[model samples]
Target: MWKWETEEHAKAVVVIIHSAFEHHRWYAWLIEKLRVEGYHVVMGDLPGHGEEGKYSRIHDETVNEYIKYIKNLMESALSYELPVYMIGHGLGGTLAVHYLKKNKVACAGVILSSPWFALQKHGSLIKSALANLGSLTSNMKLTLDINKKALTNNLQGYQEMDDNLVYKTNVTVSWYKEIQLIMKNLFVPSTSQLAIPILLMTAKQDKITDVEQARKWLLLQSSTEFQFKEWPLSYHNLFHDLEREQVFMYVRDFINNTTRGLGYIID
Candidate 1:
């Protein structure tokens, strides 16, 4: 786990959860942005993701482990006794939804960036059947074949990602199975509504995750204060995209508004 404290008095603590196949280092820009904006930031590499993936790869058994890890991070954020907000991207966003549904942690708000509720393309029937069978019986790994061009339009960002040593391109069948299980359960009606404010952003041109699925999930949320925005001409990684300044502005505004009446002082 890593914590970046702001030089100024903080208005709140923001815990960020990164997507699959990526690590905390990829979020350096976002972290510094939040820190400079007067918010303490907390984040870590997911299990079998960053430094951990060097030794062990993600398998079927790490599903519950991921939730436990997030719970620990959330506990650390709560220690500051400040209003807490969570930001989750891609698979990270899906995990955030799972964590919130099962746990009763107090969060002032949540921001989801292009959450991966469903894939943009599912392979042929034969391939799907084979994948299911492989997941049930083997721990074989499969290549994701993710296109860098589909991620962001920033050429510098592309270069940075290409040079990243810990960026994984393959995942175990069990890992895929676990992700599917979580996505399936996300649609089941919750016993209680999540009353906290939520901001869900999606890229209309995202070639990775299904935008329609994200929209459907947002409508099912019982939170009365939830907001959804779909950005046109953007890729899957909105934070690393060309309109990131505007994206950051929206994030700052949401946090400020959510905490306005709860003793949050604006500069």
Candidate 2:
């Protein structure tokens, strides 16, 4: 349980989920933006990445288990009876897509900033072979970091993060194994039943995840209400980039347009 940013008289509640190796407070600026736009925002520390955790423990769980944590989080917030909207980055985006595919959580829509359809900056043939092979073998941690530099644009800001307070569980063997499976679910070829609209923002310069792969993933989506934007100057952490205010505005306006029944899907 993290916190509710507004006094509770918000027009809607925006729930934010952060990427791996980061904590909930990482979305502080985005939360502020939503507050200014007259929305209540709630953010919680994911199981392993924040101050408090659970009986099951984050590192010990498989990727599907981790996804269940996200759904449980959404269910708890939906109980508050505010129309919910979800914004997730990287690993968080993957979780959001899973929620859309499997559950009918009543959300206004979803915003996915650089969703991890495929990990970034790797030899395509080699990476695919390894990813597939790892799925069959006992080795769980065979995956490699695609772009290590994309971890943070603000090195000082990253260093200032509390060292004792872990931000994420290290990417595990089973986690990598599970990601291949989750990716399969994301691009499921048929049964167009996605219940909510989606907005996907990718960075042309993002080194951690392939922006082209993200575009392909969006293409495979069965939902017609899908939008994609490629920010030429942005990196993996677009929400925290120098032009972050613009990113925030993009999200706010998208929410408003969707709420007003404007079919503003883009690419």
Candidate 2, superposed: residue stretches over 4 Å from native: 52-60, 121-132, 135-148, 154-169, 262-267
Clashes of 2: 2
Estimated TM-score for each candidate:
0.92, 0.81
Write down the lDDT of every candidate, Cα atoms only.
Answer: 0.83, 0.68
Write candidate 1's Cα lDDT for 44-157 as tens digits. Answer: 988877767775544343778889999989999999999999999998999998999889989999999999898864432357675565535447665565667789987766
